[model samples]
Target chain A: MITTSIESVPGRKIVEQYGIVQGSTVRAKNVGVDCVAGCQNTFGGELKGYSQLLEESRAEALDRMIQQAEQKGANAVINVRFGTSTITQGASEILAYGTAVLVQ
Target chain B: MENLIGLIFTVGLIVVAYFVGKTIENRHFEALKAREREFLDLPSLTTQHSYDEEGIQDCRLVYGNVVISGDYFKMVLAALLKFFGGRIVGYESLIDRARREAILRMQAEARQFGADAVINTRFEMSKLDAMTQNQGTGMFEILVYGTAIKVNHG
Candidate 1:
């Protein structure tokens, strides 16, 4: 399949549209990691743990967005954008969206 | 005297252990990044065909999914841990990376087919299910598919 970004992929023809194709997962922390993280802050150089966390979430959200487009029989997605929100203090949600289209 | 000595030793031990563990984790993360870079750097293979004499070409390409399952699991765990503290994880990077890689592959395929643009792209994901009694393993699939077209530059 061909995939194109909203800005890079040209043409206005949309063959199919999928309404809010979304995928989400919720997570909770283990006490062990937290206790350790708290201690590391004093001498911290980099928060590698948190960096890895965000990377994973972003991939999951994008995977869901692509799944949605495929289900709609779309050849490509255009004008893709992402949004994130905190469900609580440490918990967050990532969302990806785009317009499903077919170019003639 | 003994209590003071023990407390200091315990704190020192915890601090040391924390750094060691973090270093190991960081090393693994770096390895993952390297793998991702290698995957993206591989040349994209494309195929194209033309329909009608108007110089319009139709193209299709396949892209392999980079399933970072280990990283994903870690991030989820981290987010859960942070929930109590009210800090959220930034997930945009992962999504953006996946999208970018997929698009690049598509474009490469279009170019291979001698097409100027790609049209009608679709993505899909499949998860594997295992039957406990039968001992059958299932496979998860993620796919990005699209058509490429060549048009007049003017």
Candidate 2:
């Protein structure tokens, strides 16, 4: 299914609206990655480990959102938005949500 | 005698950290300035729609993120600022770097699709390395994302 953060798809027409579809996931890295991130923090630069973790969680959350849209028989999702919240010391939640629609 | 040595070591580390961290932050700023000039041509907006002459051919989601942490000196300075109740100048650069880098990366991704503009641009700030909000000064990630759209010239 096509997805865009903008309310309307560029060249497509929305024929039906399926309300809102959402997906969320909690993710964490291993202890080793955490330790490495701590060391990198001392130097104050990019944290590669955490970047990868965020990428993974973001993709997963989007994927689940797409699944929800598909279940609702939507061909696309629009106005998609993402949010992240730290759950604890070693885990965080990534949430993706959007309005599912049938597009032509 | 032992207390004097401890103080010396802390001071020495802070001094070294000041020099090294400033240099790194300066370099990042320079790089971001160069990129900002390039991105000016690629229109990016926070509104959900683009106001350009609308012959949009394609639209897709695009996102970029950058994670940065504090050096020894910044952490120490922030600790002092916590008591003083003022802005932490050291961390000011860190956030600036993360934000600029994130936007640039997002622009790079949009370019891959030959998109000339991005609309409904939104930013999300979060933590990295699985750190909770209560944790001490730790790594934070800045994410810039939007709907990348390619317009047809015809």
Please give the TM-score that candidate 2 achieves against the real structure: 0.91
Question: Mind giving the per-residue lDDT tens digits that candidate 2 earns over A18-86?
Answer: 999999999876787778876666667787887888888888999999999999999999989899887
Each model's lDDT comes to 0.46, 0.83
Per-residue lDDT of model 2, residues B1-154, tens digit only: 9999999998997788778878888888888999889989787799864455358888889999887888888888888889979888788878888888998988988989899798889989976645633254567888899988887875
Decoy 1 TM-score against native? 0.38
DockQ (C-alpha based) per candidate is 0.04, 0.61
**Candidate of highest DockQ:** 2
lDDT computed for candidate 1: 0.46
Lowest lDDT 10-mer window, candidate 2 chain B?
Answer: B128-137
Candidate 2 accuracy as lDDT: 0.83
Task: Say what the interface RMSD of candidate 1 is.
Answer: 13.7
What is the two-chain DockQ of model 1?
Answer: 0.04
Q: Among these predicted structures, which one has the highest lDDT? A: 2
List RMSD in Å for every model shown.
12.9, 2.2
